[model samples]
Target: MAGRGEKTVRAVRRPEVRLPQLAAYDGGELEAEGDYDGLEFADADWAGQSARGARFMDCAVRRCALDETVLGRARFIDSVLSGVRGVGTDLSQASLRDVEVSDARLGGTQLHGAVLERVVVRGGKIDFPNLRQAKLRDVAFEGCVLVEADFAGAVLERVTFDDCTLTRVDFSEARMTDVDLRGAAALDIARGIDRLSGAVISPAQLLDLAPVFAAQIGVRVE
Candidate 1:
């Protein structure tokens, strides 16, 4: 659990099989071996429903709304989404294992090519979340806010952004290995930052992003 550039964390990749417990559901299409365990979707709405390839285990969605829900390739395990709002939600290529999105409110959420293993976005409020080409493994964004989220060409493994609230979040052409933005709340107000090669910030978040790493290599930090 060292600081900057520390690698060697790539776990969460569960769900090899097991998932056979059906019953309880008030929404629409969620076929493909449907098995929503311990179901209890409260305040359900499921607008524009279409949960493709469904298979949610230990489900428990409260204050559910799922606005414009499509959930392509759905397959959440040990789920638990509270205060779910999901505006313009698509969840493209979804898989989210061990999910636990609390106080959710995903705005313009699409999650392009999603997979997010061992997810845990607490007190969420994700805005403009695209997560292009997503695959984020062992994810964990506690007390989230993630505004302008994109994660272009994403693949970030062992992700972890604790004190979240990354303003202009957007990792252009991302591929960060053991990504861990040191409990970010201001990684220089997050943007592209040269794609944050193999991210793992710490050490005071690299001295508070050192003026955005000297204006992206131009090095004129006067």
Candidate 2:
């Protein structure tokens, strides 16, 4: 478990590079050619593309928007996607390893059936995002606003949410083993913790959890 202020710093400004336009690419391998050592994509729009089996290695995408993009079966390794926004994007069956997606807005994104390992999502608004049936291991979410997000039927092992706002988020029917919500703020949210069988929270959050506990156990916390 990392602290609330823990962060990985990388070089902010790098060389500029334009991503290849796949006008009619579908179900093909779009692997990175050569080492993308110091390439950055700024203010680019990658919308409505079927990017299946695409790989992004050692790449940095800054201030870019990937709205309504089909990213199924894509792989993102050692990539930094900062200040990016995606709406209604399909990331199903994708794998993200050692990826940092910070300061991004991923509203209405579909991340179902994805495998997330060593992925960090910090200081972002991921509203209405779906993570159903996803395999998440060692994933850290710090200072994120996950409003109305769906994590139902997901397998979350050793997942940590630090100081995140989980308002109206759903974890119903999800297998959350060793999930920590110690410093998270989710009081005004409904059905967020309705299926957290083995999750833990801090003492301050326990006060908000008392009513739900009382309703389940038939006891008043006065």
Candidate 3:
């Protein structure tokens, strides 16, 4: 049985963002390095844009097109990205707090060395996302498709993947504690099965993953 893990993800606090709308958007393009606060950037087209060190507080970016955009060192607090399309976007070294990304498509996005706290990714297709060396605390991915996503060397605490598709996902050298994968669709098809030492899964999942685990230990089941 996958016993209770040593370190579950700590409870994340809500983002302290109380931004009053100061001005309205003039429909002009945003500067990449600007600090936007309390803005409602709904349905904005940010495709292929570069926003380095941008701080978004109490922002609502709904139905925005962030395809191939670069958002390195960005900070998102109390932001909700609903129906946003960010295919192949680069979000390296970003910090997310109390961010809810729902129904978004962030396929092939790069999140290397990013920090996520109390982030909820719901009903999204985030396949092939690069989360190498990232730190995730109290993060949950619900009803998402995470096929072929890479989490190598990442530190995950109290992370939960609920009702998601996790085929071919790589977690090599990752430090996981209290990571609940029992609600995943398929865990046998994932790579690096032996590296998930401290993760918690259901009893039925262990039976399904037995063949993969046996192969990792060079045991040929005849």
Top candidate on TM-score is 3
Kindly report which residue stretches of model 1 are placed more than 4 angstroms away from their true locations once superposed: 1-7, 13-17, 24-57, 60-65, 68-77, 80-97, 100-117, 120-137, 140-147, 150-157, 160-177, 180-212, 216-218
Clashing pairs in 1: none
Residue-level lDDT tens digits of model 1 in 126-219: 7888889889888778777878888888888878877887877778777787777777776544667877766667778788778876887888
lDDT of 3: 0.81
What value does the lDDT take at residue 32 in candidate 2?
24
Q: Would you list the clashing residue pairs of candidate 3?
A: 9-157, 9-158
lDDT of 3 by residue, 4-73 (tens): 5444433434334345664555567656777888778778788878888889888887888988888988
What lDDT does candidate 2 reach at residue 41? 60
Global local distance difference test of model 2: 0.72
Better of 2 and 3 by lDDT: 3
lDDT of 1 at 124: 64
lDDT of 3 at 68: 83
Off by over 4 Å in 3: 4-24
The TM-score measured for candidate 2 stands at: 0.77
Tens digit per residue, CA lDDT, model 2, 13-53: 22222334323223232232322333466676777766676
